[model samples]
Target: MLRSLWEYRHFILASIRAELKGRFARSRLGGLWFLLNPLAQTLIFSIVLSQVLQARLPDTEVKAAYPIYLLSGLAAWTLFSEILNRSTTIFIEQASVIKKIAFPRLCLPVIVWGSALTGHVLLIAAILFVFLFFGHVPGWSVLALPLGITLISALAFGLGIILGVLNVFVRDIGQIVAIVLQLWFWLTPIVYPASIVPERFRWAVDLNPMAPLVRIYQDALLFGHWPQPLTLAVPALVAAGAVTFAFVLFRRASPELVDAL
Candidate 1:
């Protein structure tokens, strides 16, 4: 797998650049929209939850600047959700190229994941600015940010590859993916903190691949603490399993993928 990814390294890089350019090619705001999208969502969520939902999770140590807490979790979730959502149709959207080109089809999902990860970093930077303004300077635990993000991206990529291949044959898979992601977003503790969950339910939340990731983000960025060992272990193992499963499925479906296209 390392060899394959290394061999296609240039293709992956070029695809990343191409995806970024195509997204902002003619837009007035261009890359700015990346920061704006997450910021807008954070603002709307924070207001609505505080006002209407009266939502507040107990035992989560968010400072007086509550948006920082929400934004921290929101950034991680947005990146994971966006990559999974977009990757479902990545190959189909580029069907013309896939039909004509004989390059490694795996690169398509990787590129989409990379582009989404890039946008995620930009959003994280914006969130960091918000934290700084609130006098919450990031501590050394911030170093874990990249690892957390990478794990989330790997999880998203694994699922994306499987979905992208499946969508090629089963058109309905894309619609199902949309609905599943919507449900998955709520299941993740992005809008609310995991600490509030009862002891019994806490295990289930932790079992979610994304649950540990969001906790890591909040731990490092919002709470100035290192991620617990179990927090990292479960999600990393899940991501590895997901990637393995996706690669096998993609390999098995490669021949038919061409036919389906």
Candidate 2:
């Protein structure tokens, strides 16, 4: 396993570069779109829901400036969702390379996830700049941002690989994934603070696996608080389990992928 990964390290790097170039090469704004996309969504949501529409939090913990809180959570959720959404078609879209080249098939999904993450990282920087401009300095807990994002990437990649392989044989899997992620976006606490969730329904939100990760971003960036060790522990374990399961399924499905395509 280690040898295969080591051998493909160069290919993975190249793939990441290729993905980035492919995204921005023809664009006038180029990589600036990465920051613009998320910022636009944040502004629209803030205006429609927070300002014009007058949305309110169910719990007292959330402050009047809910837009910042919501944006922080959405930033993480968007990354996770983008990875899974794009990864579904990765194997199909790259079938030519898979058939013509003799590289690690796993690199396809990895590159997709990496590119999606790159955009998210850019958005994070934008978020930080906005905070700093507003006189909000993230505390030491901001260090946890990378770890939180890593966990999100792990979960997204694992699911992506599983779905990417499945999508080769079942075209419907891609459409289903789109629907699922849309529903999942609402199920998560991206628009509201987790504290607003009633106690009984809170577990349902926590069980989402993405919830704890969103909270990690919110706490670190917005509230300048460290995520409790136990809070991260549970989600970390879940992400590990997800990766293990997805890898096993991906491997089992890989050999048949070419045949299906």
Candidate 3:
């Protein structure tokens, strides 16, 4: 699959460009919509919840700490959700192309990644600018951002592709996933800090795979702290396992999947 994707790299890149262009073609703002959507969500959350949670933040020095915290974690969540959501529907969305084109099916997800990453990169730059504006520049720990992104992307894409494949056989799976993602977002502690979770419910955070990854983002981007090596353990393991499993499932299902599409 890796080699297949590589062999058709040009097609994947072109698809990515075309997908992005088509997404914003009719809109005047075009690419700015990517930055605006997430930023707007951050603004609403900051307005409604910041004062309630800001004082509870571990470090009090940074100006607009809550928004910074919110956006930092949100950057990871947005990248993740974008890929996962798109992966769930990529095959179905490109059903016509899949029927006509003889190219690698794996290229579909790669195109999803490429187009989503384009928006994510823009969001990251906006986030960094927000960090600087508030006098809270990240230190060398910022280097970990890419690793953080890699793990989150792998986990989302891996799990999402399987769900995407299953979604073909059971169309209800897509609807279920959409509802689950909404619940999953609140469960992961994006708008608030994990520390604030009630004691008895704290186990939920420990069990939640995304909890650790989001903390890595907050610590690295908002606090300028290196992620503890221990923190990467669960997400890394889960991501690796998910990817391996997804590839196996996708390979087995591809033939039937085309017919389903």
Q: Identify the candidate with maximal TM-score.
A: 3
**Which digits, one per residue and each the tens of the lDDT, describe model 3 over residues 179-202?**
998988998988888878999989
For residue 28, what is the lDDT in candidate 3?
94
Per-model lDDT: 0.82, 0.81, 0.86
Model 1 TM-score relative to the real fold: 0.91
Residues 130-208 of candidate 1: C-alpha lDDT, one tens digit per residue: 7776778878999989888889899998888888888888899999988888887777888877766789777678668
Those runs of model 3 whose alpha carbons end farther than 4 Å from true positions after fitting are 52-55
Give per-residue lDDT, candidate 3, residue 197: 93
Is 1 or 3 the stronger prediction by lDDT?
3
Ranking by lDDT: 3, 1, 2
User: Which run of 10 residues does model 1 get worst, by summed lDDT?
Assistant: 57-66
Error of 3 at 194 (Å): 0.8
* Minimal lDDT window, size 10, model 3: 50-59
Which residue runs does candidate 2 get wrong by more than 4 Å? 56-64, 198-200
